[model samples]
Target: MHPPRANRAYRNVARVLRPVLYAITRRDWRGTEHLPVGSGFIAAGNHMTNVDPITFAHYLYDNGVAPKILAKSSLFSVPVLGWVLRTSGQIPVHRNTSQAGDSLRAAEQALAAGECVAVFPEGTLTRDPDLWPMVAKTGVARLALTTRVPVVPIAQWGPQLLLGRYAKVFKPIPPKRVTVVAGPPVDLADLYGRPLDAATLREATARVMAAITALLADVRGETPPERPYDMRRGGGGAGADGPAAPTADGAA
Candidate 1:
């Protein structure tokens, strides 16, 4: 397996940001052995704060896998940030439109090329009050099964200290300790080759979420709730059923 390639833009960005990130946070990253080598894979992680993505990216980059994250399309329109994202090969997700499927297709192509594709399976930051993972959209599951790629469950904590959920302030003053753990590729062998029905997707997705939640539990040194929070039924979500699951053929 060839080591993942990093473009010049990604390397330059990392060179600039890595030192600043190290200065701002005490890192406790584990499970490097779980990341797949010489192959493409999906990284499904829980979202707590806006800052977690940075920390998460730092972890993967340091481990030698340059992550291709799925970010909202709106971010690609920003001035300098957009240019960086585009040039760095990050994929844009066009939400709630006929073009929504395009993102998954792009992801599939990336995976086929042996690149790492990262996604926040929860879709948005957790609203569990205590920052536990909520019931996630099934897009991650869809991607894993359709592409038959490894789905590595990653859990991140401590970024909220830098910037709390939905908060606009970045308080990196005294610095903070950010912990991240990556679990082995989720075992979906039993479900593979089965029909991609609602039940199958939910069960597969639940496994993915559970793996992530367990890693979070390890980082937090506490037990998680009996079940993940449901953002739709609880509040602050879309239609009655929540976000629609992405199709295997590539609709997200």
Candidate 2:
């Protein structure tokens, strides 16, 4: 069953914190009603700024759902933040091979328990100068297929403008207008009986990314540049230095 008590508490905290976060960031959310009311689903979004997750969590909390994000394991190393995150039951993801299985297992257990989880399919922040979303990783698709959970695509804008890429050092710019938009959940029941092969997984993932891109376009009211977001000539050259690359249609 869903963690109703925990979710309720999360919502209460969100109601109190969102206003404060908005006061600092000046965020404006739209289309949040598109999110479903309960658990057993995955809410996925584009990863741009580091603050994107917090923005999403706060919004979800305001809308009556406490979202548990799949954060990088390294974040758990922080002193106080780590303690709060662990006690709150946030999922820790190990991107490296050594702990990937353990992370996946943890996610599976969470899903089986009827909890809602958020994932940034892009894996990491976009390094492209324009900040268009890059190709997404397949982990989200694999998780959805494994757990048979519906996937909800969310589009967020404005956080990058306030925090920019240097939010770590610089104070966040104030009174920035941030927008959060949620799309209808993408159903994968059609593939229930089919083999979960690479092609199928990619197809599903692409659809999810497309939904997010469309929502982003709506919020920005402009078409994104068509060039690849990752412009590095070779792989690994796109180390966290530049803006994120543009994604091919459904390339994520």
Candidate 3:
């Protein structure tokens, strides 16, 4: 019962991927009731492996929603893949150029048009040695505040079994079971209507990350790290060129 307004290209792509999706993985999605009824919301989740994006899209589609992603702009440079992205109404993000806000504007347009937008706040995969969530960027924060839409914090596990951040291995002999759980919409009412300053955005981003981390902890039945991984300072976090930096499929 997915919303019927999804672009024809999106539906076509889904039909093509449905068979392959079932071949390599099993899905366990909770918090189905938390999904917004119609549209105009963001689904923000942790980044672990490249496979999670499609699987997460599967999750959303199965729950009667279509996913429009904020993908890297470089992906739009490809011939065939880029065509699919454009036809499906997916947004491209310019991570390097001064025009990065273009991606946000595109996303805001999608949200306003009643499209369900998905984003990964951790600009890259977690460099955490233990694969826990690390510090995240404020893109999701900016999106939510600007549109005043619900930011649903989601957690997904087991995609790493099929493909991990640093590990290029793909072991699908038995078909791994991936668990995705969505928590309630993050509350940013107090932060709303205020100036979109770094401090406010940081606070909103922390709340979004905390909610996702808590759901992830529930999925793993373990406690998360006290601090998020910091890749820039070269602390205990894994290096960007570390195991998870190779491909951009599950890219930020």
Candidate 4:
């Protein structure tokens, strides 16, 4: 089905930037069909580079979904860029602040309104040196459990090669090839609505991470380590993320 055009601000910006992004990168998008249309849904993915949002958003738009991203509240405080983000439907995440609870509420309202909300569960680029998905903020699972929206576990690779994390280098040479894959919504059936306690949330969160990791492994043609890397401690092994990760970043 043809996607109705997004808001004017989003349309205008996409018209300008999508072409520029296409000119500099090759896209390998898969499983767009897995993202069900005509309803609100959560698209959760592993974060790679700073530019991953742009690439992932482009992929979503191309497949007929306008993306409303959950971004750092600080990014919305920037000058012109912040103005654009706010106007174009990005959600702001107020980390570690009292107002933090506001983000998830807003996201739930958006989902209830049938908007597709794209989330980077990692909260930041993978702290993993080799770029495997690391411990994640539990916000995604919270949103999934509460909203009962399909949590489509997605994975992205190769944008990091375009521009290394937290660096200013851009490699447009062969034009970095970016791949995004969407897996089926995770099965949180048994855990859903059990009790929003720590144990329940952790189990659901682990399922989200595992689903995302499997998709990434499929794209990379390699096995992910038995344990997800932990950012705070700088290591990964069996049960590293264990029972929890930093809890807030809600709505992921």
Q: Estimate each model's TM-score.
A: 0.90, 0.80, 0.87, 0.89
Clashing pairs in 1: none
Question: Better model by TM-score, 2 or 4?
Answer: 4
lDDT for 228 in candidate 1 is: 77
Task: Estimate the overall C-alpha local distance difference test score of candidate 3.
Answer: 0.76
| Tens-digit per-residue lDDT, 1-252, candidate 2 | 222536544544555555767676765767777766655678888877766767777666666666677877766675544554565667776554466566567767777777777788777786656666665666777788888887888888887775565466434555667788888888777866778776777666677777888888888888865543653442222212211111111111
- Put down candidate 3 lDDT per residue, 180-213, tens digits, no spaces: 9999999999999799887787788889888999
Q: Please list the residue runs of candidate 3 whose C-alpha ends up more than 4 Å from where it truly belongs after superposition.
A: 76-87, 236-252
Clashes of each: 0, 11, 3, 0
In order of TM-score, best first, we have: 1, 4, 3, 2
Clashes by residue pair, model 4:
none
**Candidate 1 ranges with C-alpha deviation above 4 Å:** 1-3, 77-84, 235-252
lDDT score at residue 53, model 1, on the 0-100 scale: 60
Error of 3 at 24 (Å): 1.5
lDDT of 1 at 99: 76
Task: Find the number of clashing residue pairs for candidate 1.
Answer: 0
- Residue 183 CA error for candidate 3 (Å)? 0.7
Write down the lDDT of every candidate, Cα atoms only: 0.80, 0.66, 0.76, 0.77
